[model samples]
Target: MSFKYRFAYYLVGFVLGSFFVAAVLTGKDTRCNYFPNARVLNDLRNKPFEYSKEASTVLAENWIDTTDIKNTLTYGDVDFDKSNIKFENGKIYIVEGKTVKNQAIELKVINYTSKAVLKEIKKK
Candidate 1:
């Protein structure tokens, strides 16, 4: 084989190898329990609420009602109830209902690093 032909063969082999490796990596279910969606009560738990610029503007315009806006965010595809969601900044807040008078219990995100409760507020 000529020098040019050998170089072409080597280049093609390298490209094919890279493609195969990429396919393998993407095909595997690398998602583990540590994934955000894998957590229990994820819908009702406070988490980061990522929204596009346009969506955020729309949410702010239409959903902004008083200091506390209900139904500002919806947990789509999640099994938890949607009425318990509230969006502020980039974080989502959720409240679990207890009884008629003490229903609104706030669930705020502790911090970005931990998935713990930062504060709990009961409706007065």
Candidate 2:
């Protein structure tokens, strides 16, 4: 088999495989949350959320709302160095990102099985 023939065959196979994968995945919620940050964020986003008193007060004062929090969780970066992932009750994750209004903020979230608790919200 010549080099050109083998290359052509490989290219054809690759294109077909990619097309098949895309067709299969279309209209499906195919997510790749393999990394720790993505995993934690997806888990928190799916569960019910509760806010502590201080967190609620901060949100109200800053004119932030659940939509802002949800946006943060969707696009935030987790500060693993500041997060405690081995807590007894639930893991603590520190998520930092911008609000809908482009205001930088940090969130302290406790990830429990049933729900995620927002412990604090601080504007940066």
Candidate 3:
């Protein structure tokens, strides 16, 4: 009933509640992608990716295989400044990401109602 006992009880309860919440959500797909790069990567990973004609051509020109392209898409960075504004022309998002063996690459992803298209690949 004393001040010290009340404080102790509150601290214990808070710690236990936090642990319970963490445990309950341990199996959930909870990701904290707050930065622009992380957010773009998350968007790409969560949605289905389609390649545009131009982008495909670029890939072929560079002899970049599908697996390498996939790796780039999966682990690319977003040059937010270089990227176009999203939804400016119907969900057009230009995300810049680097590949394992390459640098200064970008993907112009046009997100449609049901899918996202990699419209262009550029070497910057």
Candidate 4:
């Protein structure tokens, strides 16, 4: 085939292939979390989340509700340096994120799991 014809054919095929891939993956839960922090946070979010009395009390005192904590976990930055895994109770992670209102906050989530708890969230 002529060069012009070949280029046109290649361009059309490329566009069609791109469209097919997008269409097939539309609305699918496709995510690529390559960073260590992102992978950790994503894994945590996928698991069940729970809270403790002390965590609730601290959250309430700091004007942070359950919803805020959920938002933070869903869209937060995990500070590995601030996380203390050698706690007597459970492993703790310091998660930082902004609220829906754009207010910045820090959270200390204790991963003390039982038959009921997955993660305990508190204000950092």
Tell me, by TM-score, which candidate is best: 2
In the range 39-59, model 1's lDDT, one tens digit per residue, is: 534433345433344434533
Candidate 2 ranges beyond 4 A from true positions = 1-23
- The per-candidate count of clashes, in order, stands at 0, 0, 1, 0
Query: Lowest summed lDDT over 10 consecutive residues: which window, candidate 2?
Result: 56-65
Error of 1 at 117 (Å): 6.0
Q: Write the per-residue lDDT of candidate 2 for residues 48-104, one digit (tens) a residue.
A: 988999897887774687888989999899999999676668989999998788989
The lDDT leader among the candidates is 2
What's the TM-score of each model vs. the native?
A: 0.27, 0.75, 0.67, 0.70
State model 3's lDDT.
Answer: 0.73
Better of 1 and 2 by lDDT: 2
Model 1: residues >4 Å from true position, as ranges? 29-108, 111-124
Candidate 4: misplaced stretches above 4 Å? 59-62, 84-90, 98-104, 112-124
Model 4, 1-124: lDDT tens per residue?
8999999999999999999999989969999999977876776677677666767566666466667767877778989998857565567778888766567877766654432232444334
**Which stretches in model 3 have alpha-carbon errors above 4 Å?**
1-19, 82-89
Q: Rate the local accuracy (lDDT) of all candidates.
A: 0.40, 0.90, 0.73, 0.70
Instruction: Report the CA-based lDDT of candidate 4 relative to the real structure.
Output: 0.70
